[model samples]
Target: MPEVVFSVDQSKSMRDQAVPGHNRWHPDIPVAAMVRPGDEFRIECREWTDAQLGNNDSANDVRDVDLTHAHML
Candidate 1:
């Protein structure tokens, strides 16, 4: 198994990450990781909605989720 270069804690927000990731892409956004070509590595990420949607059979979370800071990268 490849070593994990980046990891995410589903229980927390992107900003709370040890090396916080960004939702948007920009040159100003610091590089989260760097690897040599052909390097096998892993990056664990949370849901795009940051788990705004629930696991149960309910669509309310989807309907009411505030996507103001979503699509976590």
Candidate 2:
């Protein structure tokens, strides 16, 4: 398996990761990892909504999710 450069825990929010990710990208953000050409690496990520929507028949989570924090990263 490729080395996990940036790891994420699906059970938790992106902001709760070891190296938390931001909701939006910016050039000022520090590089999370570096790799040379041909290098293979893995980056685990959570859902764009940070799992705000759960695995259930009810759409309450989706309907009530805060749009202000739509994307996790």
Candidate 3:
């Protein structure tokens, strides 16, 4: 496999949701310090849903999501 390096943001926003198949949103640790020129890796990212919610939305089908449940991830 081709080696790759990654520089990720580990903020709470970057943390993974509790989706059934997936565990966390991002890697447990940072790899920017350990990655070499040829190392390859994959990155998991959060969805835009968390960022695009309005206060008016209250129902499950509403576009405005509270992001309260991990299943939304």
Candidate 4:
């Protein structure tokens, strides 16, 4: 994987908001705080089961989803 760096802006409005879907990356604490200009990390992004479930799947699949084992994109 290639190295990634974040340059974030910390403004008053942003401080009160949260990053959707990522509890760990709150607006108050920008990604810049955790990474430098040349740091690298394995980033994993995942979607809600309800959002990605196939048409053939039942609602039960979403209800039964185990967040702990959910796939990361």
Predicted structure with the largest TM-score when compared to the true one:
1
Candidate 1 lDDT, tens digit per residue, 1-73? 9999988887888888888868888999889889999999999998888778889888898898888978989
TM-score for candidate 4, please give it.
0.26
In model 3, where do residues sit more than 4 Å from their true spots? Answer: 1-33, 48-73
Whole-model Cα lDDT per candidate? Answer: 0.87, 0.82, 0.41, 0.41
Candidates 2 and 3: which is better by TM-score?
A: 2
Question: After superposition on all CA atoms, how large is the RMSD of candidate 2?
Answer: 1.4
Model 1, stretches more than 4 Å misplaced? none
- Give me the candidate number with maximum lDDT: 1
Lowest lDDT block of 10, candidate 4? 6-15
lDDT (10s digit) by residue, model 4, range 1-73 = 6543322233312223233233343457445335556666643333443134445659876776667634421
RMSD of 1: 1.0
Name the candidate, 1 or 2, with the larger TM-score value: 1
**How many angstroms is residue 44 displaced in model 3 relative to the true structure, after the best TM-score fit?**
0.7
